[model samples]
Target chain A: MALNQTLSVQRLDDPAPDSPIIEISHLQKVFAQRKKAPLEAVTDFSLDVRRGEVLGLIGPSGCGKTTILRMVAGLDSPSSGSIVVDGKEVTGPGPERAMVFQDFALLPWQSALENVVFGMAATKLSREERVARARAELARVGLSGFEDHLPKALSGGMKQRVGLARALAVNPTVLLLDEPFGALDAQTKTLLQDDMSATLQEEGCTTLLVTHDMSEAVYLCDRIVVLTNRPARISQAFSIDIPRPRGERFRSTPEFTELVDQVWQELKAHVTLSNSQAVVEG
Target chain B: MSSSIRTAWVAFATFLLLLAGWWGVAAIAPSSYLPTPLAIFERLVYFVVEGGLLDDLVSTMINIAAGFFIAAALGIASGLIMGVSRLGRDTIGFFVDVFQSAPSAALVPIIVVILGFGREAMITIVVIFCYFIIAVSTAAGARSIESGLHDMSATFGASRWLFFRKVLVPGSMPMIIVGLRLAMARAFNGGILAELLISIRGFGGKMMYFGGAFDFASLYALIAVALVLTFASMAVISLVGRQLIRWT
Candidate 1:
């Protein structure tokens, strides 16, 4: 399409293909409370996401994994430290990154296609080009026939598909997924994981996925970073070392199981420690 | 279609029941005070056919429409500002709270003293009656938009104009429309009340003329006309609102 032709020639200042596209150094976030001591959420957390690689962040619930993702997406500011994306220091949200929320935050009043188009509002594309790109992205996510449906008319999985399509429609340099499939049922989750893996391979898009599900992290991520309890710090980092386009058969393999188990074992220690701490505090 | 037909039948049955109740009450009450349904119906026919009440009805409608449209414009604009800005909330929203709680009819005499008992005074009374409720409800609607949507808009790097047009306005529409429906009801009450108190004009004037002449049937007829007009306008607002937010 003419729109694709224009987009293909749009990226003139791209960095080296193998270089890190996003660098987060020594990030910290604190939540202030009235008449009480301020709470620390994330501290000394840092990571670099290489171009065209899927990185996963996993931890127990409320471990600030999503907080780190929001920081990278520029939806929230860090209390200290810095994030550089595409050779630019991030001060606020920009067109370089798009987030797929866990809640499938599609605008209830907009159709699936319009929601996708809304994401392209920051781009320099014309109205027709925006509509064309939106349609193409929606079709890419298997929502061609359902473009006119509102988010409420869609099931959980379909809604997330629209969310994914919206993120992808802007041709963002980095895609941020905050438990994108966490709200779906088990069966739908499995189906979407497979589709997501295939789509990531096809697009070769850089991604930072925040999820608590160990198996999901193992299946999709090239590298997994496990975080500790609140005031989250990186506790462990594991490389999947598995080949790309890993299929459903890989989920049954001993290698996948071993990798998932290893991550789970690392996460279980933090969970136990936080649970005991919670008991004491309560 | 079938459900709509059933709704119409139910409405017609209710109307008949209400008329029967009124007729029974009329029999026990003094005839001069509470006219029978048939007597009121005859007076209604007279008004429609030859009583020159049509001109009064048109003038009252004009006052109501002018007052309501002006109030709506100012209310929605100020309401949006109050909703999104802290300063606006503290200032405009503060007065909205005060006026909404106080009965607006209490201000009609003051309004007459200021605007001096005419169409302008009547319209000002209608504005005073309707504005506060619309502003209050619109502000509440604006405040109730989900935080996630705001975050989503920010992440997309939406411009302020785009955010207002696409997110803030549409997100707050359901409540804004609800406020409009309520304000419309108040508009009718205020317009008629102003006409009665400030000037001998409109349907209010006709009612006053009938009441002074002991024509209870004509007074009741005018009251029924007002009731029908209010219900019809409210239904129209509801229908338009439903069409606009079908996605919800």
Candidate 2:
């Protein structure tokens, strides 16, 4: 249950940072197959992620949350509609949006330090500058001592931390996290969520996190976006008002419980709808 | 040290057993078909002292080196291209199947006649023999690259050239090295066969010559040297592969 804590809002008079770092409009994505059924993964999904705001997307598995994120990240193209990031339509992958993949996706041949360095190299940073920046980013992710270790040698959490450091090193305007902490143990996940939230706040970067964990979304995000199952659409969005530096105690509040129930109820209805649709289609 | 000592003792016992078996067979048969172990050992020492085998061995080494280099260069380049592009993959894939399945050894006499027996002819044969193996391995290696790494590079704005140089090359290195090892073994066998039929300046030719002259001891000694060379090549490849895997 998410707390009913009135989601905090930026001062109305204060200008929003640079006008929607990511603006996705009516995006539709369909995965077509030959001699089989066609899959509509996302349908007319739209959202505006403003600068310096953490937007969490929570849905059941295969509800097209990942498809939305991938389209926004420019890893996949939308079948219809435009994705304008920083006012430019995205047709392919660009450095402006850096993604932290679910699996850490680090190059196996590279060490943690080298992975960070490679990410920073996109901006044409000098070799020394790249190294220094990589060290600083690794330290930021609490990986100061494991810089020289390969990804295979690290635990899943540590590897994801390396993935985080790699994305942060790029200094992108928007960060796309596709269930970045899904693979970690509960303790590690909680700790990493705190670390990631703190880092996103400090960096003042726009973020889109796709996750199945409702609590995680409620904890870290300024707003939560819910998507309906296959051929998913924006079912609803909720604002989370917990203050900065939100800690464990926040999860226990009456407000949090109210909001969590509200979102879960909506999600259950969507799931039922998905099942009926599946049965009919089958 | 203990393990090495144990290994040495085992090796010594094995050698003694082999020698005794050979001598026993020779004493009972008194056959011209087989030479005594002692006679072969003495002949080997004499050949080394007289440098009779050195020239032949050097010639074979040169041919193998030249052939292996050419095969490696062509194979790796073509393999990388085929692996990276769908069109290249489709085109070269068919050629690889043909070359891999065709009678490689059967082409030896034809190549010898066409090229006119010389160093070039031997090298051509060895190169043709090893190329398909190396190319197919390298191509398969490139194709087997993890999609995550490819996406990672693309997300980082890696240009095609940079991606190939930094990502694809390192990722495929281990498999490519394995391909090289396979090619080296093939080249060795091809080199020996080429020497036997077309040239008089390699160990293979010397072996044939000794056999014809009734110098069975020298022929056996040459066979032993060839075995040692093959083993040495395998050892070198393994050592190099271990170092490469560690560094990567």
Candidate 3:
């Protein structure tokens, strides 16, 4: 990164002060499909995301972490309760939030430049300003000179970079990621994780991530919250004590491994109980 | 070599083989009924230069083009509506299914009585045959876009127009083009039928005139021109479609 020398670490190895930018209270979601049993995804969930802190949501496969993330993005509604961003009650989608999807959700018809420009499409900014900002953001994400390439022509990593550029281009007050690197291969995910660490450090936006990987949560989040499967609740929350500017060396640190193991231990017991119960029912 | 060039060469080879086969068939059949390749070629040139038949061809094309554009506009609109709205799909979807398969020729006699024998009637007939196919294609195309994509757009606060223009139109394009190809092919077929049966005018009428006079060579020439136009349009469309959906 060209800005690496200028980049301040902005490390919060200590717990952040209670300056909550995003507040969720008694949030719940229930899916009612016709001709099928109702599925309760989340129940009695509440959390406050501190300003400039990366908060991670990790849970079992169907724990509704994505549902909670979507609700915060204002794409889904809570069956009951409220989500407030910057003290304004979020009813529907607003430009103050940007989401990075797991599937790379890039519109196939548009080129990377156009896709990145999509972020500012809802804004009142002049077209020239939008175009300039889009170019700058794509370049910031290391996607310079590949502006006109369509998502289909890009590799998985390149496509995700476009997604990242699209998200960060608008300069949203909140950053929401639903397994942003989940679809990438191990090598690519690792590389992206490092890049994301740098980007998140630089942007310093309030970040919320939903992931299945414990170590990934530990690596990226200042605080990681684990949820229970089906009718999800905050089972536990861990404050990651690992130092920032996370590099390859961070993965092997004792604190990092110990934290991951602790999360695994809790999640493992839950999974085993659920599996044995399913076997008995079957 | 590039795939497009390889395809062009293969197409050329196919045409050559078809011509050779036609010549062989003409040699086997009686001279009065089936004209030789050289005979058709000569008659084609004569019509182009002396008979003023290009005007008739142009007239037929104008009707086809009119019907095509109208159908494309309406079909895309209806398709997008159907794809997005469940109520719209439920209400009009049945009509789309029934009319798309209805023998296009049957509609001509009924339409002819109402609109009278003219270009308007023929254009209407062509549109009736074409629009349903295009609509069905686009609707299916629109439905195929994943829900995650829509969620992403909504999360980013995409306006309704932006969603339709950037998301729906482009997402459904691959199938929409396929539908266009099918609809255009039907347009030519419908145009020929309407012209042949309606008032004995345009390229279709010229074909009929040659046949009634027992001029096999000229009839073959007209058919050959029609065939060439059909293939040419399809080739151009496929090339454009390839360019549009390169990402997939």
Candidate maximizing lDDT: 1
Instruction: Count residue pairs with overlapping backbones in model 1.
Output: 0
lDDT of 2 at B98: 79
lDDT of 2 by residue, A155-258 (tens): 99999999999998989988999999998899999889888878887998888999988888888888788888888887778777666657767778777677
* Runs of candidate 1 exceeding 4 Å displacement: A1-18, A276-282, B1-12, B28-30
Candidate 3 local distance difference test against the native: 0.86
Count of steric clashes across candidates, in order: 0, 10, 0
The best candidate in terms of TM-score: 1
TM-score of 3: 0.90
Model 2: per-residue lDDT, tens digit, B32-75? 76888888899989998999778878989999989999999999
Per-residue CA lDDT of candidate 1, range B66-140, in tens?
Answer: 999999999999999999999999999888887788877788788878888778989898888888878888888
Q: Against the true chain A, what TM-score does chain A of candidate 3 give? A: 0.91
Error at B11, model 2, angstroms: 9.5
Output the lDDT of residue B100, model 1: 80
Q: Score the docking of each candidate (DockQ).
A: 0.65, 0.45, 0.62
Cα miss at A165, model 1 (Å)?
1.1
**Candidate 2 vs. true structure, TM-score:** 0.89
> For model 1, how does the per-residue alpha-carbon lDDT over A125-203 read when each residue is reduced to its tens digit?
9999999999999899999999899999999999999999999988888999999999999999999999999999998
Clashing residue pairs, backbone N/CA/C < 3 A, model 3: none
Candidate 3, B28-104: lDDT as tens digits: 88478778889989998898789689789999999998998899999988988889999879876778877777887
